[model samples]
Target: MLVSEVPFHYKRPDTIVYRCIETPRNRWKTKPTVADTILVVEVVSPTTVTADTIDKRSEYARYGIQHYWIVRMANDDGPAVSIEMLTLNSEGRYVSNGFRNRTDDYAAATDTLTPFPVLLTWEQLDEGID
Candidate 1:
């Protein structure tokens, strides 16, 4: 139900999965491993641009996460949750599934937002903002 910070463990001896250290702990009290993750959404910041857009994007794809979303919520030209969606393709690489903005509806690639059957609305995510 919660989008917890989970790491992906690989069979390969040396694989690096990114980690986020700062947290409030209400939502991510339990961390999950990468393999256990169904979807990974990263909220980008200036310091995390390289890691989120490049390294994490590559690693998550390689690790075979079915759904990956890079959320640019703050730096956008306007007020909107600009979502860059990626889905794992047959060749084991992540391909773009197009983009969605705040006004747009994101019915999760998994088709359900999980734990609750509903469209992925901006209001759903805004709950934590206040």
Candidate 2:
């Protein structure tokens, strides 16, 4: 699904907070800051690569997004693969705790997941599904 399609909400003790709920001018909603358990994914392009890697990275960290996946699609090569994964640390800063190049299988830290799983690989991504 596209990034815009995901529903964002803030969870309070007694109610759910929604951003940009009653605004005509605020057509596009900004990222959520509720600190709920969620995953945010951004598909990267040449033009948006820098913004995705730098600007949004800061924003997502500011809002305490648990998992941020930057999917980079290569030209004339293969499907998109995650170039970087940032996990929020205890110090309220995002650390590049995980990464995978075009030739490696992406793996998360064992503490991050039970039984620790490797999510994807270059070969699996390059093999385009029909």
Candidate 3:
């Protein structure tokens, strides 16, 4: 299951992926904590580069969220966006796994280590945005 803008341990991530069983039941009505999260994604805006790239990166890693993705919007150069995929290493730090740009013909997939593979494309992400 995926949720958007839901609070976790400290801050609300842009999006989060978790097993349906791990999420709170409807009546309990609570958000998943960092421990329940399998993946967390942050969309980077001009003002959020540092917070998403550095601050939250370390925070999520420390909290043991296994996967993190950073989505960067298009700049003056073009309408192309990019997604940077990261995985937690044995040292409890995030390492770059893959990066996909809008101009690329192929979508990016999560590695086999993840519970399931997710296919991401810039078009899918940029939909509904101005």
Candidate 4:
């Protein structure tokens, strides 16, 4: 949503698309053709986990958003869970790309990925987010 307010130009092999609209209802909108190869992340909650894992999974597949992630946090100490990454397959199903516990580095998920090349970690996320 942060980036949607800005206008930009997207060029494809056959088209030079210009998007200038602002204040759109759904800022996370993605085109079906390119959405299958894009990454999407959503913070998970007790009520939302099921939807994120099942409902949204299907929706993303329908829309063709290839990669999706659900980050969950709980009170248990077994694992300071923070992040989960899902990658879409040719069959339109998402597969677990990675899961990071409290101390694990999140940067690994960004390698070789477009629009997300920076490294992140649970420690960094928890430091300020609580």
Q: Per-candidate TM vs. native?
A: 0.58, 0.55, 0.74, 0.57
Q: Residues 62-104, candidate 4: write the lDDT tens digits.
A: 6566567766666532223766667778888878776665655
Return the clash pairs for model 4, or none: 107-119
Task: At residue 29, give the lDDT of candidate 4.
Answer: 47
lDDT of 3 by residue, 21-92 (tens): 654567434656555788889988878889999998998888888899887766723344777889899999
Question: How far in Å is the alpha carbon of 32 misplaced in model 4?
Answer: 12
Query: Whole-model lDDT for model 3 versus the true structure?
Result: 0.71
* Local distance difference test, each candidate: 0.59, 0.54, 0.71, 0.53
Give the per-residue lDDT digits (tens) of candidate 2, residues 1-130: 1133357433221112233434332543443334333556666778876787888778667766666667677662346554566677888777776666654543421124411344555556556633
**Cα RMSD to native, each candidate?**
9.3, 9.5, 5.0, 9.7
Q: Where is model 2 poorest over a 10-residue stretch in terms of lDDT?
A: 10-19
The lDDT-based order of candidates, best leading, equals: 3, 1, 2, 4
Candidate with best TM-score: 3
What is the C-alpha lDDT profile of model 1 across 35-99, one tens digit per residue?
55666777777777888889877877777777777777656332336767677889988887767
| Global lDDT of model 1 | 0.59
TM-score sort, best first: 3, 1, 4, 2
After TM-score superposition, the amount by which residue 13's alpha carbon in candidate 1 deviates from its true location, in angstroms, is: 21
